[model samples]
Target: MTKLKLSFLFLSVMSLAIFVACSAETETITKEVEVIKEVMVEAKSTLKTVQDRGTLKCGVNDNLTGFGVLTSGGTFEGFDIDYCKAVAAAILGDASKVEYVPLTASARFEALSSGEIDMLVRNTTWTASRDRDLGNDFTATTFYDGQGMMVYADSGYKTIEDMNGSTVCVLQGTTTELNLDDRFTSAGLDYTPLTFETNDPLQAAFEEKRCDGWTTDKSGLASKRAEFPASAGGPDSLVVLAETLSKEPLGPLTRDNDSNFYDVVQWVVFGLIQAEESGITSANVSSMAANPTDPGMARLLGVAFGDGKVADFSFGVDPTFIQNAISAVGNYGEIYERHLTPLGLTRSGSLNALWTNGGLIYAPPFR
Candidate 1:
C-alpha cells in the first residue's frame, strides 16, 4: 500500500473509534440525567405515594405526653399526634389512615431522609442548622416553645446559674443539647450533659438522680412533669425553671426538595390555624362547609359563597383538604386545648395563642 493511502486509512479508523467513544459517553450521560430526573420525580411525589399506599408513614414520638405518646390503649395520642392525624386526614380523607413510626431524636431525621417515614411530626424543633443542614424542610411551627430546665422542686435551684456543676439529662443529636451547652457555657458555668438517645433512659436516669436536672423544650418538660409517675413523687415534685435558653419552634418536617408534600403539610397547619381564626370547629365544620357565612369562611372551608366558585389552593389534594383536617382534629385552638391545656400549658398570654389574641400563632392568607 502507498504511504498516503496508509495515512488516510489510519485517520478514518481513529475517527470512527472516537465517534463511537463519544456516542457511548453521551449515552451514559443521558442515562445519568434520566435517573436523576426519575429520582426527583419520586422525591416530589410523597403526597401521591401516601395516597396510593392507603396510609401516611408519620414519624413521631411515642413517649412525650401532651405531644406524641403511646397510650395504654395501644393507641397514639397528643398534640403532635393530632397534627399527624390532621395531615393524614388532609391527604387521605381519613384520620385513622396513619402508620406511626416512633423515632428517637437522633434517628428522626434519618427516618425522614431515608423515606422510612413520609413526614416527621415528632416534636422536632425547627432550627437554622436543622433546616439547612438536614436533608429536610420544616413546615410551619406548630408550637412555639423554648428550652427550659426542670429540676426537683426542692432542689433550691431557681435559675440556670443556680445549678453550677449540675449534670443535666438531655437527648442526644438535638438542638436541645447544643442549646443547653450554649446556655451554660455562655453563663461561665460548668455543667455536664448526660446525653441519652431516648427519653426513657433519660427519664430513668433523672428519676434515679443520676442527673441533677432534666433539660428540654419547656413544652416537653411540661409534658414530662404532667405525667410524672406517682411513685416518684408525682407532677408536683418537679418544676420547670422560668429561664428559656433558646427559641425552639417545634413543627413537622418532610424530606428536602419535596415541595408538593411540603406544601400540603405546611398548608394543612395553616388551614387549621385559619379554621380557628374563622370560628370553624370540628363540631361545626360540616355545617360551615354547607353554609359558609362569608367569602373568607367559604374560601377557608373550600366551599362556595353566594354562588362563587370554590377557592382551591391546589395542594395536590381535594379542595376540602383543610376542612377534612379540621374535621379530623378540630381547629388549632381545639387541638391545643384538648392536649396541652390539661398539662397547664395555658394558651392565653402565651406564644401559642392565635394572632388575634396577641400571640404568634398566625398563618398566611389562603388565597
Candidate 2:
C-alpha cells in the first residue's frame, strides 16, 4: 500500500460519495415537483372550477315535501329547492339554468366531494364533526330546526316518555335516526327504529300502524302532517312532541377548498334575509330599485348613479345578483310563509326568527 495508491483510493471514494449525494438531491427535487403538480390539479378541479364550466349543479332531496321535493310535473320544489334556484339566480343570473340532482342522505357528501354536484342544498344538518372531518364547508344555516317525535293523535302518547316501547319510523342514514337512538338510550327506554329510504314509504308504514310513532325534524313533521291524506283525519291527527332531541342547523353545503363558491351560496341566503330585514319584498323590489336611496339597498341592488361603479364583489356573481334572487324567490320570511307556515309551523320563540327578535336568523352586513 504505497502513498500514491492510498491517494487514488481516497479520490475514488470521494467521487462515489458526491454521486450518491447528487442522486438523492435530484430525487428530492422530483418529489417536491410532483407534490406541487398534484396540489394544482386538485385546486383546479374544485366546485368553482366546475361552476365556471357553465350551469350550476345542485344536489337536493327528491322526496321531502316542503323542503326538497321532485313533483310529478317533473319540476323540483321546496324550501331547499328554492335555495338552489337562488344560488343559480345569483351566480348565473338565470334561476332556471340549474341542474338538480336528487340525492339521498347517504350519498349527499359523496356526490359533492366527487363533483357530481356543484352544491348541495338538501336539508342537511351542520355539525362540528361534519365540518372538520367530512371535507365539507357549510354556509350560513338557512333553516334552524330541531329533532322531534310525532305520534298518532289517538295513541294517547302525550310525551316522548310515554312511547318508550314503541316502534319509531325514521328515514335511514340521517341524523334523525342517530338522535332517536341517543335520546331513547339515555332515558333507558326500549324502542325499535323502522327505517325507510323515503318519506312516502315511511308515511305509508306509519299510517297502517306498522310503526307506532315517527321521528324527524319538528319542521319536517309539520310539513308531512300538512300533506297527509284526509283519510288519516288530516294534518291535525298527528302530534309532534315538545321534546327536542337535537339541534339541526340545516343549510347549503359546498366542497371544502372552494371559498368563492361557498361565499356565493352563503351570501345569496343572507341577501334574502337582509332584504326581509330592510323591508324589501319581491313585489316592491323593482319600485325600490327605481328610487334607490338607502345605502344598503343600493349596495344590494348594485346601483351606481355617482362616482365610480360599484366594485364587482367576486363570488362569480353580477353586482345585482341578490336582486335577481329576491325577484325570483322572494325574501326569507316570504319563502317561509309560502312553504313552511302552511305546515303549521311558526317563527316566534323558535330559532327561525330574526336575530333582533332573539332567534338565530342573523345575516352579515351587505357592504
Candidate 3:
C-alpha cells in the first residue's frame, strides 16, 4: 500500500478503539452512580424514621415517682417524661406526639435495643458498661442524682451506718440495688436487700415493715415521701438519709449508629439547659425569640442565619426545633421545679445545677 493510504487506515483504527474505550468508561461510571444512589436512598430512609411512624415511642418507668411515674389517670409524669416531651417537640414540633411505653427497670435497655422504643428516658443511669456494651447511647443527663436510703422518721435512723443488720427494700434491675449493696458492703455493714419489681409493691412491703429501710435515688425517695399515705402522716413522716451512695446521672438514651437522631435527642436536653442558663423559660421563650440579640440564643431559636441555615446542623429537626421544645415543655429548671421540687427534692448543692453554679449541667454553644 502507499504511505498515505497506510496512515489513513491507522488513524481510522485508532479512532474506533478510542470510541470503544470511552463507551466502556461511561458504563463503569453509570454503575457506580447507581450504587451511590442506592446508598443515598437507604440513608434518607432512616431520616425521621421515628416521626414517620407518627409517634415517638419512649421507654419509661411505670412506678418511680419524680422520675418516671404513671399516674392513676394512666398518664406518665416526672423528669424523664419531660425529656421525652422535649425529644418529641424537637423532632415532630409537637410535644404531645409521643407514646409512653412504661417499662420495668430491667426492660428499659432491651426495649431500646430491640427497637421496641425509639428512646429510653426511665431515669436510666449512664454507666460505661451500659453505654459501650449494651449497644446504646446516652445522650445527655437531665438530672444529677445520687442514691440514698429512706426510712420512717420514727425509725430514728440518721445515717446508712445506722442500718447495719437491717433489711432494706430496693427496686430490682437497677443501679440503685447494686449501689445499695456496694455501699453497705464497702462499709462492712450487713444488711438484707428485699428486691421488688415495681415501686407500688415495694412501698406496700415497706409500709408493712417488710424491710427496715427503702433504698433508691434521693430524688425518688423524696417523690415517694410527698405521695405517701396521709394516714402515715404524709411526707414529713419519712426522711432521706443524708448520704449519697452513687452518682446517678439520669438522662435520655437512643440506639447507636444514628447520629442525626442522636443529635436531635441530645440537643433537646441541651436546649432546655441552655434555655435555663439564658434565663429563658417556657413562659418567656416567645418574647426572647422576638428580640433575640445574643447570637447563641438566636442560633438556638433559629432566628439568626449562619453560614448555613440553622437547620444545617442535620439533626433531623427544623432550625427552630429547640424553640418549639422549650415552648412545649419548659426549661430544665422549670421542669425540675414543676415535677421535682414539689416532691421535696432540691436543686442546690447537687450535680443538676448549672456549670456556672459549680454543677455538671452544661450545654454546648448553640452555634
Candidate 4:
C-alpha cells in the first residue's frame, strides 16, 4: 500500500476512537445525574434537623389520664410519654432529651403540620381523613382503643342504649366526637352533645353532673376513672360502657414529606413489639446480640451477622438503635403495663393483645 493510503486509514481509525470516547463520557455523565436525583437529599434532612436541635420535640396531650397527664413534678407520664421517650432514645440515644409540647386535640395536627413538634403521640386516632388530608403520616398503632360512653354507675345507665336523649360531654376535634354522633344517630337516639377543648373541664363537668354522660376513648375514660375521688363516688362511680363505639389505633405522627423520619418512627414502634415476641427483653438484649445465632434476632438486635459485615438495615437509624430504644423503654407490653395497667386497662382479649394471642398487634419481621 502507498504511504498516503496508510495515513488515511490511521486518520479514520483515530476519528472513530474520539467519537466513541465522547459518547461514553456523555452516557457516564447522564448516569451520574440520574443517581444524584435518586439519592433523596431531603429525606436526610429530618434526622439532621433533630440532631441539630439536640432534642426531639414531641407533641402530646396535656391532660388525658392514661395516655398523657402531667405529674406534680410537671413531667408528663403515661403510655404516650413512654413512646416519646422511645423515639428520643432511638434518635438521640438519650430517652430524656425531649421537648414536650402539650397540645389540645384541636392543636395537635396543626402543631405537627407547622413543624412546631417532631411528632404527635397524643392518643390521636389513625383515620382516613387525617392520613390523606392532614399532610401527616401515621406509623404503627401503639395502642388499640375504642370510643365508649362513661357514665356515673348510679346514673341508671347500664348500657349505651339506656343513655339515649341524655346530655354527653366529649372533647372536640377527636374521633370520639364523630363516633359518638354516629352511634347515637344510628341507634335512632336523640342526644345533646356538649364539647370541650380539653379533658380538664370535660372531666369537671362530668363530675359536676353538668352532663349525664361523658364520652371519649374508653381508655381515656378508664384513666380518668382511676383518678376519680371519693367526693365523686371514687373510681368505681364511673363505668365505661361494654359497647365499643369505634376503633382507635393510636401511634406516632409525623409530617407526610418526611419519609425517612417515618421509617425511623415506624421501626421504633415495630422494634418494641418485635422485642416482646422474640423474648428479647432489655435485660437479655446485650447477651442476645453478643453473638446471636438466629438470623432474625441477630439482625434485629444488631448482633453478629454470622458474616464479617456489620449488620446495617440502612433505615437512616443507628445499627443498634433498636437496642438503645428497647433498653431505655421495655417491650410494648411492658410499657403498656407500666403506664396503663394502673388505669384498670388490661391487654387480654383486647385488640391491643399480641397477634399470638388473637389480637391485631403484630410487628413485621425485622429481617
Q: What lDDT does each candidate get?
A: 0.89, 0.82, 0.82, 0.83
Q: Which number leads on TM-score? A: 4
Clashing pairs in 4: none
Instruction: RMSD for all candidates, in order, please.
Output: 9.5, 10.3, 11.3, 10.7
Error of 4 at 55 (Å): 0.9
Residue-level lDDT of model 1, residues 1-367, one tens digit each, is 2347546655655565566567857665556556655555554589889988999999999998899899999999999999889999999899999999998889999889888999999888887778888878999999999999999999999998899999999999888899998889998999999999898899999999999999999999988898899998899999999989999899999987788889999999999999999999999999999999889888888889987898878777999999999999999999999999998999999999899999999989988
Candidate 3 root-mean-square deviation in Å: 11.3
**Taking the candidates one at a time, how many backbone clashes does each contain?**
0, 0, 0, 0
Q: Which of 2 and 4 is ahead in lDDT?
A: 4
Identify the runs in model 4 with alpha carbons over 4 angstroms from their true place: 1-44
In order of appearance, the predictions have TM-scores of 0.88, 0.85, 0.85, 0.89
User: Candidate 2 — which pairs collide?
Assistant: none
RMSD of 1: 9.5
Best by lDDT: 1
lDDT tens readout by residue for model 3, 193-256: 9999877889889888899899887778877887889886777888888888999988888887
lDDT of 3: 0.82
